[model samples]
Target chain A: MSIPITESITVIDTTLRDGLQIEDRVVPTALKVEIARALVDAGFRHLEIGSFVNPKKVPQMADTAELYRELGSLEDEGVTLYSLVFNAKGAQRAVDAGALQVKLVISASEGHSRSNSDSSIAQAGDRLLAAIQVLKANNVAFEVGTAVSFICPIDGPTPPQNLVSILEPLVAEGAAGVGVADTIGNANPRMVRTGTKAVQQAFPDMPITVHLHDTYNFGIANVVTTLEMGITRFDATLGGLGGCPFAPGAAGNIGSDDLIHLLHREGYSTGIDTEKLAGIRPTLTRAIGHPLSSKLSTIPAVPEPAPIGRASR
Target chain B: MSIPITESITVIDTTLRDGLQIEDRVVPTALKVEIARALVDAGFRHLEIGSFVNPKKVPQMADTAELYRELGSLEDEGVTLYSLVFNAKGAQRAVDAGALQVKLVISASEGHSRSNSDSSIAQAGDRLLAAIQVLKANNVAFEVGTAVSFICPIDGPTPPQNLVSILEPLVAEGAAGVGVADTIGNANPRMVRTGTKAVQQAFPDMPITVHLHDTYNFGIANVVTTLEMGITRFDATLGGLGGCPFAPGAAGNIGSDDLIHLLHREGYSTGIDTEKLAGIRPTLTRAIGHPLSSKLSTIPAVPEPAPIGRASR
Candidate 1:
């Protein structure tokens, strides 16, 4: 039997945040603002522009606070700009910037937590509680997401219970939603379904987001599986820009451009301007000083749409 | 509900044929024999080594007849070597070469048929009738396949009825199986599911194989869709080496190496050796004089498998 395509989907553009976080160049705050304007114009209502991490450690996002101040028009348009807050200090920066919403990040696996956050999973999560409190006190809505939620390079595969336990504090702290990040992008469809299903079952009332990478080319397959399971929100980067340290030279997030191409071709409404979306890749490539990893990055012109056989008739 | 991973699947590697046909250099017959030996050693029971088209038209496969004779030992091991025969002349070549099996190819759309085969779809079908008699007379087990079976670069999307009507003659000739090709690699999951299911429903008893390219990064997603629909036979290439003439600079077939990785990690059995499969990329790259398009071709080593959460526990 043929699976019916969902009529519409919500795509969270994380290009300026995760896409450029690990890149060598520090994109000017002006360029970041320009990209955000283009994104909003391209029909992306949700965007992750930067992380509120320590500037010394992540200079790429040092301008995130500045970006928040510069995005007056987008915020006025009721667009959601997500700033990743890793700790209480990061949360304080978002509050200082008057951020409307924040995504608190932690690792689910013990090894990733220790290496990524300089603490164990529990310690890393506990640190988020302080961040959660600051966000709540400041009246800023926040969502908590766990990295390495499915498979960790250091701690092996994460148990569903471990993920649930890790999210319990944030959920208790009144996280508006929970997000699961397949940070290294090695997850298969089965892992996605099982792991995301576990998280959804654990927090029955919370909204969930699925973050994916294309390291093993399983990203889109997992996306299809996620859609088949009725989960809507997805995080994608422009031109597939993020790189996984674990999967060196592998592709980053499934490209938002590529993902939109798939969605539209599959008869799903994403409210994205395909023409405007295609225009962003050139600007992104120039800003990054390199070609992008997404398939669309290499394709100069989009081919005419080919209707499905029976659907056309 | 989550789709159950099939216990096993049949992967038909079209590497030597489709993967190399369009390469700048014609891989020598001796080298092809060596690679074919490696593929067989790597646990591929089904392989498409070459096409029996005219030397004047596709000189890259001028050695197809020789490859058949050279693969005597592999055939003794019961590995099926499929040679593509486009018309009566090509079919005669297969018979002369004592080909154990042949894939008779016809395009489903008139535009692709005119461009690729220099004949209309109906005219191409007429040519295959003579080819079919030759194969049946020679006791050659054969399968029929249609290129541009899903979306035609020239014909837009081919109707499913177009495909069925084209295949009817071959099915009447007692063909062993049928294959549908996304020669342009532009299919989305809906297209893959709908087009494939239509073919399956039309021919209730015939075994079906899906052929795909990765022009728009939809290859693996389409693979997942086909698997979800319970169709197990897949055609892939080593290191994603095939090129789509319709969509140049896009990816070729979904990489056999990548496909095997997905299948194995998803807990599906392919009996294909990942280690041996990984080793093919280097040799394939050297032979082709360039890097391959497959994700696995970029990675230096295979990452250790991360177990699925609940499944592991």
Candidate 2:
């Protein structure tokens, strides 16, 4: 008998943007484009290619425009390219660069908002509205991401009502979608499911994407819960790269290969090639001069056939 | 207004027993005693102190009797010490060594049972019955552990009916309590909840302990889900130590310090000194010859205040 209620998941890789943010060395615009192409080739349909933030703040994203130009030229069919933006100015810059979508991040925790964005929820919502207006004017799809939606490292627990309150204005302002980020990776599966269900109930039609970090090692579990909650789109990094330079205890994003393997194993359709994604770990390892954090990077000694039986089998 | 139902969780440190099973080197009996003492000192009420198995099969557990003798002399008033065994002889050995309780592990997965114990589920159950009879005759408390209860790495997903069948006989054979072990770390939180509820329903009064491995990085999430199901007791290793020496993908138990921190943060009373437990990582690191897999080992820049805020504030 077949198991009922299988899920279809979409993996959105953000290695070039968020992944490179944690790297000490600058990744050239060409290298970013190359990684983007590699992710696309690996069957990642949604790619948060880069960010349109100030070059001074994020020197690695200094070549965001150049990277976007290169990606636009590739005209990679079957891929939706996206860029992260902090404010209206960044949103405008992303639109000017012909970016298809832009993501604006706000913090759900007040302490995180003050420390990371220097704005309260109300002020952050204003900036988000302004950014959404700019994206709307340019006819670009936009997503508002609420960071520390699960738990904040600076502040203690994020009350669910606080998160729902913060999301209400963004949904009312006509945000194309919402991204819930466990910024400091403190979310457990129960918390993820609770928050996701609450958000889904509040905004029935709004598309929700979960951005998770592996700091506390709940990234994969949270992703699983999100999948069960009918959230298909997720944010992952190649080789589990990226952490916020500003956020203490911020570690790698959930590894693309690891996430894809999990999704595939759970009988979900994620379209990504696990072997190809595992192949790129060497390049990232060489570039970073250290091993990556993905468990799938090193092949286990006794390779059991994929669970659910391989499609070929 | 009260948000939800939360309960106190009991943490059972199993590092010296199950954790040592996966160690590259055989941990000295003295080291096991020291680790057990540390766990007890850190306010762990129950500890799986050692395993009474054949030296040829599991060299690391060969010192089980010696370690048990050492812990027996220790002045731990609150700690309920236990040892693991496979058959009646092992239970006799533990009872002779002054163990308060003994655990017999029965593998639910046929492939694991054959590989791990050279027996089938029925044979293992028969062995467990003999062991329980021996323990009961000696008036020593005992619990039955069902390994690979959720899923097995060797065999694919274990059907719940199969698990129920394996457990039913044990419950009838005078098992004081029962535990479910995610032997190869393949269980997600949903699986944990489902499996736990089923077993709970089958044996309502049987105290259930959940042993999780962080192989797929869902260990903590699984623990969280089990806790939500009102299952209190859990097994954790110091620094995420121990894996199945024979199981291919099984690596690292859920770290004790990490789990304690997570529970403490979620308002669950685990009674563990997080700071003292964090301090124990160094000694474990020295013994293991490298840093362990725990994320909480690296001291957070924002120092965690003493567990003084809850009751006092």
Candidate 2 chain B: worst-modelled 10 consecutive residues by lDDT:
B304-313
Clashing pairs in 1: none
DockQ of each: 0.50, 0.28
Model 2: which residue pairs collide?
A: none
Off by over 4 Å in 1: A1-6, A244-250, A306-313, B1-6, B246-250, B306-313
TM accuracy, model 1 = 0.95
| Chain A agreement with the truth for model 2, given as TM-score | 0.93
Query: Tens digits of per-residue lDDT for model 1 on A1-313?
Result: 2345557888999999989988899999898888999999999999998998889988999998889889955878879999999888988999999898899888887677766777777777777888888888999999989888888776566777777988887888888999999998877787788889999999989989999999878888888899888788999999898965443434589899888887777777899998898888888888989988888887766466544454322
Off by over 4 Å in 2: A73-76, A109-111, A117-128, A159-170, A188-198, A298-313, B1-6, B73-76, B190-194, B298-313
| Chain B TM-score for all candidates, comma-separated | 0.94, 0.92
Please provide, for model 2 over B217-305, each residue's C-alpha lDDT reduced to its tens digit, 9 standing for 90 to 100.
Answer: 66776776677688888998988888886688787889888888777656678888876787777777777676677677643634442
Interface RMSD, candidates in the order listed: 4.4, 5.7
Which lDDT values do the candidates have, in the order given?
Answer: 0.83, 0.76
